[model samples]
Target: MRGIIDLNSDELPKIQDKNGALKRPPAGKAAVENLKIDAAILRQSLVAQAGAEIIIYKDPTEAVSTGVLGDVVMMSKQSYFETFEAAPFALVADGGEVTVTPLPINRAAIHVDATGGLQTASGIYGLRFEFSRATLKSYPSIEDAIMHAVVQGLARTGDAVLTAGIMAATPAAFSLAAAAAAGVRMSELRGLVGTAGHGAAIDNNGVLRAAGIAAELSPDLSATIVGSFARSAVMIRSDVEVVVDRTNIDGSLAVTAWAGLQALLPDTTRFWTVAA
Candidate 1:
């Protein structure tokens, strides 16, 4: 296992045998495979999900990122809900001349009338992160941290806005919690299929399939009420701006990004808000 050292070369990695050559190891103890360099290190991937988005109005393209910050997209303040009614047929007696009733399958649709009008995605919402130069060097994936911060901050802010809007619009009698209920049911919310649970547990907000109203926890609403809502209830987003400062007054690298976010409810009535 002992071999001559290639000490003459200036490179630390180069074999430094007295002859300036890296001596190859035998296929045993000092073998190159012993390092297992191929699988020695890896960085984890981080992702974030926003419940607010589940109930918000969105275009198909909004989900795909072009590797660019994005551009302004005009969205409508109004949407429509359409549904079909299934009719039942009676089994007619042996039909020689039985007058069979024609099934009348009626159709119904409603204009959601999102009344706020087209909103400007001009509201600024963002966050700044700073790390000392040395700290950034030592820590891995600050990029992921930055992206996650933006998403979570945005989500929390949007939820607060949407919940506040609904609360403000609801009559005082129903807005404030007189007492906590066992749970809010889809039937209670008028067939809306959703649940809001957070500050409280399922005891207050029962479990349901991930549909109806806001399918996920309404970050702010969970504390007071639990109900599902129509999907076209909210709208969100806009352009992004990122600023990086390596030359800091305190020698820390600072990262900052986009603002100009919009959280608008077309029709608050489309939402079901009640005391928990």
Candidate 2:
């Protein structure tokens, strides 16, 4: 195999432009690793089309909770109690005082510990690609092939996990078989109940900016498909950083992409499945 390129050491060299001054990173700046892959490369997944949030903490060791930390506001009176059933209430005569239970309007509650299956279990999925040093040099660019390969894997498994989480969150699958032609408001369905602040906690999910509800196809569930799940139903968290491992004698390389994924469906009422 042609000589392996060790970007950290071999690829970079020292050079001076007349003044004898170093043209390298100044002070505390670290040279670019050029190893990490952009998440955008594989945006053709169900999670991506579903308006899922991708959380990426800056500090690798910044430390984060396993479960999602979020809150939900009581949209209706039923939302305040354990048995959440939408029932009708009669109006009393004007000024006719009657004894009735106190109300908790727009009650806001926090969920650190998951109640029921509203939050899915957190699992770290790894996508790895191992190739010979000669194979890497053969690509138009090493990062491109690795990024595309690993992300495609992510999108596939990510769907299984996402579908599983939603199925577990609710008793039955949220179907959109008989919905409007235009589909429903993406956020309305997966808002996870009302959020005065919880929305901001998870990057407002991509739905906050997502143009419209997309649909799900047999293969790719991206911005193009007749998308469904159509809003922020699932969340994917990862630094999107690539970890490089060197093979001993073979001089091959393994590029890996890591992510912590979870399905959050506190209240799936607002969501509707879309099929196009």
Candidate 3:
């Protein structure tokens, strides 16, 4: 008895092996990991860039307490307290009269009104390659585009917050001519801060442009970005979130970050104008 041969076995049938059916390839794990690393690096770079532009006060002398208040956040400020003088007591030489001088009372009180609300600075970015012609060509993947957008947004947010804080402080002004050195703008900034009784200084491109006392006097003060934090400094707390959607062929990504800017001593902060 001859066994029957199935011709259909050799022929490519419409329905192949049920167990070996063709399916879409799963997304690669390496690709996802690479994207994550790139995104983190970009985020960090942006943060540093923003930090350089603005003065963030994180003085070790002061203390910052963080807490939540309803939908808002609160940061309590405790000023640095110190007393250098000692009691009036002097060593007396044998048979010699010792002079006694009254001790001076020096007290640096924490400003009761120093308490401030943590101001929220947020940046949001969306990456939709289908809708973005520029991104589609420039970025190798949607993740790359999303990362760049997120970084840019975060940097901008930081810059804006710092700028506003400096403006509000409104320290005194110095002259560009009075600048200690030609290339060193920070020196001039230091002078202004010293005059305003602040110990710290911030000099950036924005400050350079704002250079001028006349500009500072204007109702819309627009002097160099130089300013002083006075006895206390500006503090910041930040949080970041990122999301990616791979449900469709044309996927999307989104990133958001929030930074809270609070002054250690709201009343102590001062801004200055740098004049030519």
lDDT of each: 0.37, 0.40, 0.35
Better by TM-score, candidate 3 or 2? 2
Residues 53-144, model 1: lDDT tens digits: 32222222223234367654433343323222234555666755656555433221122223322233325555677789788877555554
Per-residue lDDT tens digits of candidate 3, residues 1-276?
A: 112112112111122124654322112222212233223322333223222322222222344455564354344564433233335567888999978675543333333333432223322322332334454455445443443444344334444444455556664554454333223235323322212322233345434123432112111123444433222332333223333333335543323333343333333223444544
Best by lDDT: 2
Clashes of each: 12, 8, 11
In candidate 3 the C-alpha lDDT for residue 134 amounts to: 50
Which stretches in model 2 have alpha-carbon errors above 4 Å?
A: 1-43, 47-90, 96-120, 151-157, 170-215, 219-231, 269-276
| Top candidate when judged by TM-score against the true structure | 2
Q: For each candidate, what TM-score against the reference?
A: 0.43, 0.45, 0.35
Residue pairs with clashing backbones, model 2? 188-270, 189-270, 189-271, 214-227, 215-226, 215-227, 215-228, 216-227
At residue 137, what lDDT does model 2 achieve?
Answer: 74
